[model samples]
Target chain A: MKTIFTRRFPASVKIIAIVVLSLLLVLSSDSLAPARQYLSTFFSPLQVIASAPLEALDNVSETVKSRETLMAENQKLRQLELSISDRLLKLEHLEQENSRLRAMLGSPVVTTQRKLIARIQSVDTDPFRLQVVLNKGIKDDVFIGQPVVDEHGVVGQVVEVNEFSSRVLLIADNSHAIPLRNQRNDVRLIGLGRGDVHQMELQYVTKNTDVKIGDMLVTSGLGDRFPEGYPVASVTGIENRGNEIYSTIRIRPIAQLDRIRYVLLLWPELATSDASAPEVLSQ
Target chain B: MRRSPFFTFLIIWLSILCAALLQILPLPPLVDEYFRPQWMLLTAMYWALALPNRFGIGSAWIAGLILDVLWGTTLGFNGVMFGLCAAFMVENNHKLRTYSVWHQSLILLGLVLVYQMLFGTLSSWLDDALVTNSYYASSFITLLAWPWIFFTLRKVRRRLFLS
Candidate 1:
């Protein structure tokens, strides 16, 4: 053993050693969480420096937009704001009525989700993993498994958090899956990302299920990872093979997965309080 | 070879730092998704070929770890691929340096393809992420960019050491 240690290993032996070591590291990734977090914090300032030029370019382009286009955009936004305000008034009344009905039925009250807005610091360039680093983290009460959304809809979830930065696994990543229900029919299904920025797959939906093109899917909240009723995706294609038991339902995620510049992190209010509550009361 | 050890180490680290920065710089979505070259890999390959004794398997492993942290990949995924790439280059450094630039580029294409294949397969298996055909397009771009990186680094080495 002493002689072997003193002798220089051949290149092939060295390569095999590295391969074995790395495989071990991969198998024990959970143990490396602290290291990953510390490194993420250390790299946060460098990421800011690297992203500075891109931010400046974005600002310049925003400022240089033509007056006509700006005016049209402003007009469109004003109309949208007015409509949203109208809906908000009606929504408030509906919420009050919903609470009254729930009280009469002796059901638990719905809790509002707490949210924090975070700027996207950088996107993972690896074509395989769809992830983004956000500029908020544990210091800001960010935690793993927090549901992330943009103005449009559900963006992804926080996978790793450090002192000042966190990584979001986008809904379009192949490994990510969300519990979704058809907004129109209330049929629950699992939405799985297909690794495309524009697509997701709804798994195990039977052919006879009342799903159609353009049916909006929202979080069912069955998995407890995401809050209920957040828009997730919309059905785009349904391939119902006569011989197959389940139909292949494709969807387009409502959130602009690739174009997101900012996302809102949601902290579910019930998750904390309901843990101590009786199971029946919590339900 | 005559340069001070500190100076040599500083140059190597500075080059690696610049490559890391370039790796993370945001480009437009289309270009970023399809055209982004593997800057760190290219830099490691350049140094490993130029000075095999100085920058070998260990250097490549460090570079890969840096990339893993920056890209938020599993810690040692890039390390394995990078160490293997560097080892292959170091074993054949003498023959590789003697080849023409085009031939060297062809060899780089092969190396990068293997790197991507290994990375993609492991990621897909371990992380369950899908790898598309366009992910391999960057290897071609990396091949195209090799001569430029080679000439630029060679000039830097000549100016800093030979002069």
Candidate 2:
């Protein structure tokens, strides 16, 4: 037994032992749970440190580049402003008539929930994961699972919140699904993330469905996670066959997935009433 | 007595931090998806091949754990891969040391390929086909990075350890 112990063990045996022992160590490290959150929080300082140079570069270049872009955009906006002023005058007259009609009909006015604005500090560096780290977190009343939006449309929702920063999972990630309704036909479906930035898949739409290319899809607000009526995507293609049970519906997301510096995190306000309350409340 | 153990440990930890920093740096869109240079694995592979006495499987696993956290990956994913890579490199260090730098470059390319393949397979299995490209592109990029990385680290090792 002693001689055998003195002899070298087989390399395969050593490999197995190494794997087993590593697994055991990982299992025994009971502190890894909080350590992960701590590491993410602690290492964000490093990301900020690393991103400072790039951010400085951006600021320097942006001032020079924006002069040319703003000049061209300003000319375009002048033409648009002339056209919109005429439309706005007509719209004001129509709105007055519509309000009189609404008063006679005894209908109430609808108000939207107020939005809290936040800035994008940095994006998650992982390629597989689609998440962004925002500058506002729990300290700013940012809660997990709150919807996020930019000027174009809905972008994503907050998933994890630290004291100073929150992680927002974009709509393009695999774990997220947004309930949507086709604006043209009111057909409801769920849009699942396809792991690509610009694309999402509409699931559970049957082959006989009437969804087509260029159909606009909006949030259904079934889960109350995202507010209803916000534009989500436009269907780019729809494949339906008699033999297949489901249609392959592709959509291009309305939000600019790659180019947002600021966004709003929307927290839905719940209404509580003692005896009788108004029809809606916005927070 | 020539190399204090604590100092070596500090260097290893610093190297791992450098690796994480490299991972976090913004990459161009064209090369972003296909190439994730295994910075920690490369560092461990270097130390195990050149100074086997100073670092080993345990060091590799710890670096892997740190990488897993930094990259927001499942626990033990990189840890196991790093452990296996380190163990293999150490076991073959003698033969690896005997090779010329050119031959070593090719062998190191193969090692990088293996390491990437392990990561690709493990991550795809965990998340259901999240990883693609199968290391073909990463292998090319890693091969390109090998000579410069090897020479630089070798110069550092010589200056720090050999006098």
Candidate 3:
């Protein structure tokens, strides 16, 4: 057997053998996961270098912005801040009252997990898949399956993590589906990506289901991958047809997925998780 | 003067690196879908054809592996595709060398079409992707990129051998 193995085949034949073996290895199991992680770490610098030209262009565009627009933005923000602080006062009071009620009822208080802000470096907007490379990873305690969100709502979960960067499989990928509950009716359904930037469709809803256009959908925390009560998408259209068993419901993602720049990484599993870094940015 | 093989290999990898950069370079929202060429594949194919004895299927397989990581696919998905193309180029090197660059590009158009269909079907089956007819736009765009990449690589290889 050793003598037969040592006998060399032609180069093409050898390459064919190796390629088929490696492809099978990858397809059958995740034994190469560690190797892929290290390779991705080694490749991260190249990824950053590839994205530099776009970054430079963005910088140039940022510098030439008008002062008038900045001032107008600042003026609008001051009013928003004022209104938010007023709401915060009421929220603080309500939180105290709710906690007291919870204590009396012998319930556990909700714990706030530390979060870190990650900047998106590059995006893979393929017809088959949707993904983005974030400029944060294992060193920053970003674990696989970590929930990611933008300022407005849930963006995606961390799918691949390297030493210095990780890849996020966005909710808009055709292969991706998220558990969600309608905010108004509270009916639970799964949202499936239609491989488009702006649309996701609901699954397993009957024709008689109560759904209306403009109804908001939030993550139900059913799978525990996404935190509870964060906005995911809002219903854009709904169609009921007798031929189909399920009504066609479309929802537009709340986060501006097309122009996403920054996202927040959440620490969902607090104590048992290896994400114990203390210097994280609070969400 | 005997040129160091290491330097030539470096030059080859650098060229492929530039191709990888072009692969990820973002464009305008409207044009991006139609314009991204298979830069890495084209560069590897040029070398596999021009220097089959040296580049061979091995380098192309490695290039595909890197692309798999870069494109975030399962490890050997692109490695298989690229390996197949590089092996084909090596086998057809003599017949291909008789043609002009434009003629070679016409051949590339056919290869790109087949590659695209196979890729689409495989991805849809494995990754559950819902693909449409519009993905074909990039194949023609890939054909358009071939001449520029071929000439540039040819010039570089000549410069390396001369010194």
Candidate 4:
């Protein structure tokens, strides 16, 4: 029943100490990257355990899937693959001719992307940040700032790397902004996340800017972080409120941000001396 | 019965882990961060009240640090707030333990308001942490959840052996 404040480890003093320590940790998170790796290594087991139910649900659905639907899907995929392969044959020819032309110009040889498949490990980021944990990490050569993309388009970039898992800040996070160009007219703009999973707003868009509904935006390669020419988002909605200097243009990410399962990690060709580097086929 | 402090240690760590799991459990977006009460803080508050000497500011600080990692908030961010919260609990442990659940809920609401406000503001300033109008939604649910958690945890505490 004694007054707790009078104790040696006084509440006020402890509060100040903790606050200072917490601020220090937050402000210098970059310096604490190694510390975060160790912390996540300890917590990865807990994260793995938490992800078990999700994986189980995935497995159950996979097993309980009706054979008829799967057959239908397989047939659809076969047709799509046939068409894709046909186009791929033409693409290979075009690629060779383009690379040959570039070689004739004495430009640097085209470098093929080294891709590794990774799975989304966790999707429970608080509303404050939009991020997902990838099961691949430092062990998998997931260096920070690596671009992640699904088959459709750009998803996000690696912000924090751990031992066995890394965190990717989604392109839809408010803090995230990507340089993009309109696919139709090649007009350039930056897409900024509005904290929504699918929607991003165009930055620095004047009312007279050449943008319209359904315009596809691709990576402009301005930042050089994300590779050029990847489809990012399409213009979903364009609005001009009265007297507003800038038009409000909403773009939805081409990648399915809501239900992420698997994605490909891109590396600069021969960027790493690891085993996976040499296996990349030149496109 | 004189119970070993190890029992207290076990209870705190076990509950902390459980809270961390629940806090990050992949529920739908709306139900996860908004609907979920401040589990880590609630656990810290309950134990700080039940065992004031054992579960004080230090315990809450550690719980918050873990949550900072788990919640994807700034490191030590939740730690600082939870530590302050634990200080409040330990300082007024006698009064809070004696207060009716209804009254305690009101007090808990005030504490949550502070936590949420500081979280929203600091997270925005510290980094471009997407603070929005919906940030206060979490505080609302945390307020509504206090009475049920207080009673359930009180019952659970009695069942556990503590010195």
Candidate 5:
């Protein structure tokens, strides 16, 4: 057999060529985003097929849930629903009064946002990134930057939308950051994910900031990606070093990132026009 | 003994598809994070070692491209790594085949380490983030898995084609 390294072009030359090619590809990755999105259209079906067995296993477990446990869960859910209905009655009265006050002040009436339920198709296994693929996509009117939440609080934002599947960048991803404020004191801060599923870090807050352990952090709506007043995380730890410029504040995300089975996709009031902006910018 | 070209091609493609499927199998998050083997790389190395002329750098590059798309990474990231690994395997195929399985496993451990390091560096550079140590765990897992993978592929190749 002929050897790969001939006298003319040795192994070193081939290796250099591969290195240069790789660097060029990396540098041009942004330009290749469109290609990647197009390719994802093809991958969507494969993803569905790959996750089929897991989905089947989940169904089997659901079917095997004991009747006694189901009855207990049902009782608990009914009691919770009754309490929530009571709160809803009070909220309805308060909302009507607030609308009347707004009309008296001649302000525009608030519009109700639309929401869609999306099932989690699969979770990305990359340790460095925390992302999940949702079953809803462009066909379901899911758009990039759409806020996703669960029963508890904010889950993440839709980053990539394909035809049948969309990728959500979780709040636990290292690259994710959300502008949030302390629910108690209204002290605004940026919560950044620490590349872990359980924790996020509060950045740019000074040691003297009025943040305390167990304080709830909610989206401040400053970035326009997530809606205002949605729970994001709760302060879990605060370390104030003597010589440090800022305090190290750690938070536990409210949404169970690992256990997410379904998410609600919020359709922003200005979604129609704003949805196209990300595609254009990405190109 | 000479094998039919079509049969050989079929086996190669089938093995690569199986590897890709294994790579994407849904496992528990913690186990997936720390223990997922580099299936495509191992299959590429197997092909390069067992049948260098038929499945060399070009085949490895193609397999890597498929893995890149599957893993949703930068297009050429895995492609370049797999190409380099296949190049090394092809260049040293004779010596690698002559060695015992124990020595082969040790050599593969080194190769897997280099592959992990290169991949970690490239991804970190692209994302402008620090490389996490968990990335190295995959290489260790792949090293432990190499002997089994090599033996299985060898058995398959021999069974499929009487060479």
Candidate 6:
């Protein structure tokens, strides 16, 4: 009876031993960084393969759209074009006048160069993080720190570069922060990412600051990583608690992350005249 | 009797694909950024609860590693969370086998809470991160999803393992 009990005891011990061994096996994968890198490289091709079907489906749907529907939309757009023409004429005059005024004030002419267009190929598979992968990569001269922007506003900066693709870390990522200044009053503040793709929080603003709910925040050019005068966000709400040293300012990001089709990767030219420009610029 | 291991593997791969799709789908404005549904977690939870003999802690850890790479998070955060959760479920398999739907749900909810706390604490310690209450909001959603996932998986198992 003692021998039989001892044998059964070893059987239970074996079960526990197996469970512990399996647990160690599970935990070991986390420590193997090389395995992850290898898996990403291995899985990237599969991602590209999977996304291709959706892209093709999108193309086919667009192609198969009825011409009658297109004609009506084109006619409506033509009417809109006629109405906006006068505004464009006035806008051109205003732009020239503004440049002239800036020249008179001896402000350096802000010229942007080195624009490379890239299509968004993928989005990060992590729900909590906001990141996008672009088709442009080192092959297209895209670098890790390149600034990606749309016509409307700044989008994000390239965080990782692959052979044929690069990943953009949006301003709403928890790790991203940008130096911003109010476009109206030029008061400087640090726009910290709230980890939400739609919102950023402004920090270090004194209670006496002139920031209002509708104030526009633009890149201050203090951070060399991002260019100056790019629209970052607009203040959506502000509260100056009577006793607090600083006001709490919340901003809504201007970029339409979902609507992005094409983005310009701004690769600064080292040979440019303003390449050595001072980091500090008044908002 | 032989288990259809190949079919099980294929289903896992399909689930991973679905999880990745769920991760990328844009949410509405009211959804908190930190509170997005953890598809990988749900899938891992399902596998561990249903098929401990096949999908064990080792499988969960591998899936978590993929998540870490895709998200660019601190490397092992999701991995450790996933592994621990799977092991917890596996150890309780015999007890879980006899549980009713409601009881299973409560267990899963507790497991989800534990997973979230593990990830949250690790995040705060590593990066001085501050997250809102939205992070835990997914637990309710996951509980609602658990029964559906369980039933669907059971159907799949019957179809695949049928002699």
Which CAPRI tier for candidate 5?
Answer: acceptable
lDDT preference between candidates 1 and 2, better one: 1
- TM-scores, one per candidate: 0.89, 0.79, 0.90, 0.90, 0.86, 0.70
Docking tier of model 6: it is: acceptable
As a TM-score, model 5 comes out at 0.86
Alpha-carbon deviation at B123 in model 4, angstroms: 1.3
Clashing pairs in 5: none
Compute the DockQ of candidate 4.
0.62
State which docking tier applies to candidate 3: acceptable
- In model 6, which regions exceed 4 Å deviation? A1-38, A45-61, A64-112, A121-125, A135-139, A163-165, A184-187, A196-198, A207-215, A235-238, A257-261, A271-283, B1-39, B49-54, B124-130, B154-163
- Name the runs in model 3 displaced over 4 angstroms: A1-8, A96-112, A123-127, A269-283
| Runs with alpha carbons beyond 4 Å of true place in candidate 2 | A1-33, A65-114, A121-124, A271-283, B33-36
Clashing pairs in 4: none
- In terms of TM-score, the best-performing candidate is 3
- Which DockQ-derived CAPRI band holds candidate 1? medium
**Which candidate, 4 or 6, has the higher lDDT?**
4
Task: State the displacement of the C-alpha of residue A115, model 3, in Å, after optimal TM-score superposition.
Answer: 1.9
| Model 6 lDDT tens row, B1-163 | 4456676777876886678655554444455254455677777877777776567766787677667666656566777677777777767777887888777877788888888877787776764455567778766766676776677767876767721
lDDT of 4 by residue, A1-283 (tens): 2334546766778888888888788889888878877887788777788888989999999999999999999999999999998998897676666656766777533233577889888646655888898888888888989999988999999988888888888899989999998999999999999888878999989999999899999998777688777899999898899998999899999999888888888875422212221243221
lDDT of 6 by residue, A63-172 (tens): 99999989998999999898797787886576566656666777644534567778777444444456787777666777767888886788999876666667788888
As for candidate 1, its interface RMSD to one decimal place is: 4.2
Rank ordering of all candidates by DockQ, starting from the highest: 4, 1, 3, 5, 2, 6
TM-score of chain B of each: 0.95, 0.88, 0.94, 0.91, 0.93, 0.87
**Poorly placed runs, candidate 5 (over 4 Å):** A1-17, A92-112, A270-283, B1-7
The iRMS of the candidates, in order, is: 4.2, 5.6, 5.3, 2.4, 3.1, 7.5
Model 5: per-residue Cα lDDT over A77-122, one tens digit each? 9999999989978976765676567667776342225777888886
> For each model, chain A TM-score?
0.84, 0.71, 0.84, 0.87, 0.83, 0.71
| Residues A216-246, model 1: lDDT tens digits | 9999878778878889999999897889999
**Per-residue alpha-carbon lDDT of model 2 for A1-283, expressed as tens digits?**
1221242555466568767865664565455545555666776765666556767878888777867798998999999999997997897676556546656777522313456778776533445677777877667777768899886788999866666677788897876789999899899899999878889999888887888899999987778788777898999988877788998988999998887778877766542212122232222
Candidate with the greatest DockQ versus the true structure: 4
